[model samples]
Target: MLSDLPIRKIIHVDMDAFYASVAQLDNPELKGKAIAVGGCETRGVISAASYEARKFGVKSAMSGNLAIKLCPELIFVKTNFERYKEISKRIRKIFLDYTDLVEPLSLDEAYLDVTKNKKGNPSASLIAQEIRERIFNEVGLTASAGISINKFIAKVASDYNKPNGQKTVNPEEVLSFLEHLDIRKFYGVGKVTAEKMYQKGIFTGLDLKSKSLDFLETHFGKSGRYYYHVVRGIHTSEVKPNRIRKSLAAERTFSENLSSEVFMLEKLNHIAEEVSKRLSKSKVAGKTITLKIKYSDFSLQTRSKTLPYYINDKDLIFKTAQDLLYQEQLNNSVRLLGISLSNLNTETKKTPEKESVSVQLKFGF
Candidate 1:
């Protein structure tokens, strides 16, 4: 029965603690130490943490203050994106040597379709092993590889044996492998979705497979259809190599919460200016303008407007954000504000007239 399905050899490769590992590799003194790359212990959010730091409850997007509290001796290093980008390029080049169908999830992770590779190797498992070896030898970094028939399974399997390891799920073993997998472990299933599934008496892939399409659709809406197929080992989403940026945005967190509309308007103006600069630099314009607000209590909301014509001007972006800000009721003190443009026109290649005035406001509060 499974022979009728189109089988593709997809591989997901993920670097192990990319930024922190790079720092550790460059500085031997940092090895075996809890390291965080982003900001100092006083402020800023952690962009990445070493496995040692992770063991101490330090994680990315967490405040530096909290990270220090969790791991008292945590070493802090500023981000070096230029170096990371260079390393990412090297890794992509290595992937291209094997297959052109590479989809990068981030600077550290990518999905490669290698059913028929340049080496004429039929075994996806062997190709993944060689890729990992090549990355280690050439880039001096460790990567974990997951091999399976499709992207979803490959992504999940990559984490099974992490930190310079690999796991392969053959076509015949897909269903059996997913049966015992926890519902929370499924791709795209978050904490809230897991809780909802738990409440609905679904706790594993086995349980999910028991639900009929109509029942799942009636309960979970559009996502139910997704769950229904994924549980039965039926994911067909191809690896998109040249994924376009859906939106470009700039946001800042204030040191102190502002209750006054005047203060929010000032912050919004700065954010809008930064967004406009990014759009102009990319030689792209968009019709949709989005204003994002985060309250002092951490509650967030977004308001957006789509215009008939595309724009990349700072004045127009700020004006649109200003209108959206005034239209909504300020229910709570504001802590963060962001502006974004989407539905882009990438054909325009206009050179920016001036340098961008970008700002990074890190507020401990």
Candidate 2:
């Protein structure tokens, strides 16, 4: 009997070295050169690195000192987390323009479902290109995209081409793609799991497919069943929204309402990082950035910006808060700072149209 699961139109969009790319976009001097965002100081980590820096073995989460060691000339800068968040919001808003079914994988990557789309155009590949172009034109950054029949295939395909390229894996080609794939490349099969699979003679998708369901389940737990289907180019997960509140923030009450540049930057970055991690985990994106500050004697002021895009980058996020931080001068100094992001929406599949709401994804082949 044929399964009830219908094919889908899924596109995975990933910005090319998002943080570093944004920095490069803003500074012509950094163009085509290796750049890293985060503090240039010893304790800071590399927030993002350009392809050029990546070529030299620099990567995000690597220590700032080690990154500079890898590339003596690598440029290190403080992270503008607020700025990143604002820009991320703007970028995501673009996705919502196409479809409400966007599942953000990270600040720089997301899966869009265009299965039932608003755009009259039926080609997801074209839509991906249009989104990429729109991002470049509006945000001054470049992104790569991948289109496929499901999120599993689309996310993997997005990485096939990097730095402003787009690729698509149609349904007919999925089985073939899985057949030749290395076991290590299978989603959720990391080094340890791959080694375990190797011990079980599962070096490729073919080997995995050969394993009986009971045997796989017995050995690998619930994940084994997942792997079994993946080996066959099948996945049943849908783009679900309204998951849960990822985060709630608290503001510090200080001795006095404060106006301090160093204090505000410190507070905003911490909050943005906290919010970003939660959003990343929930696979969600937000379009609103809110800032809260209280004056010396207890006068409170709140500011927010609804970006035209969605984002999760800490630097961008922090910068936006920083902008809010300075937009109004504190009449009194010393007490309370808060940052929050609400109006959350998961960006999924999208098609190109100004007022398009949802995408209708259909597999061809």
Candidate 3:
């Protein structure tokens, strides 16, 4: 039986080493140099590592001391989030130029559904290439893009070529391509899941496909069906442009470890203020307030309290975070403190223009 198949054109764009790349682009001398963006070389963590520093195993969230040990010549640069956000805004505008179905995963990555685009173009691959070129020329930053039948394939394909590149997987080729891929490379398969899959004798997509749906379900639980469909090139997840922000957070790593409650309270106040500013900027309020603390020895802990109602006030933010902080007994000197608000209210009334162009995603191949 020949049934009409719903074909989609999805594109996933990921900026390569975004923070480090921006740092290098803004500073001429930083080009071709090993640089890590974040705090001082003596304290805190690396937020991003340039390609040069990455060669020596320096990565984001690694301790400054270890990063320096890995790459002795690594230069640490302070993160300029304001500048990065501005560049991200410009990049987002470019995506909106093609389709309104743009789902930003982060400041540097997004998924775009261009099945029926504003450009009146049917070629998703060409659009991906054009977007990458425009980002490099207009934003002075390199972007990698992947075009495929669905979001899962596109996101995986984007990482196939690092730095600056694009890959397109046509609908007809989706099944064959997935079969050759490693099991670990599947979208939601993490280290623990991959290890479990390996123990089950499922080492690759081909291996996974060999098992019966019932067998997979019997072993892997609810996720079993997810693997069954995905291995057969089936995923229905859409690029949700109207997805609400679940959380707003801001945190800082101090140059010196704080031991006293006074110092912690002051830092929490600053962090709470930053979170409030972000919430206000987004015009969103959240009910849950979380306080994250990283000790000098690299251990991390978090304390959270959910309120009865949403709040965006700085005073309330500080007070909530302060209360959480004081409730916990000091076990060690804290190297970093952070404040975040989750359970956010990001609902927005849809405009007629948005309603007219909203995408309807299709499932399966």
- For all predictions, the C-alpha RMSD in Å is 9.6, 11.8, 3.6
Q: How close is candidate 1 to the true structure, as a TM-score?
A: 0.88
Could you tell me the lDDT of residue 144 within candidate 3? 95
Residues 1-365, model 1: lDDT tens digits: 34545677889999999999999988899999999998668766689999999999999988788899999999999789789989999999999999878889999999998876798887788888999999999989999999987789999999999899999988778899999999988998998989999999999999999999999999899999999988888887777776666788998877677899898888888888889888988878999999998886678899999999999999999999999998869879887788989888753434333222221221110
Worst 10 residues of 2 by lDDT: 353-362
Among all windows of 10 consecutive residues in model 1, the one with the lowest summed lDDT is 356-365
Candidate 1 local Cα displacement, residue 85, angstroms: 1.5
Q: How many backbone clashes does candidate 2 have?
A: 63
Q: 249-327, model 2: which lDDT tens digit per residue?
A: 4344443334668876887788888877866876777778888876555466889987888877778788888888778
lDDT of 3 by residue, 1-365 (tens): 00133457889999999999999899989999999999557787888999999999999889898999989999999889899999999999999999989999999999998888899887888888899999999989999988887788999889888879988877667788888999988989998999999999999899999999998899988999999988877776777887777788998888888999998888888888889998988999999999999888888899999999989999999999889988869779998899999888764444233332223343221
Q: Which parts of model 1 are misplaced by more than 4 Å? A: 259-263, 346-365
TM-score of each: 0.88, 0.67, 0.88
Give residue 246's lDDT in candidate 3 (0 to 100): 76
In order, what lDDT does every prediction score?
0.86, 0.77, 0.86
User: How big is the RMSD of model 2?
Assistant: 11.8
Clashing pairs in 3: none
lDDT of 2 at 247: 36
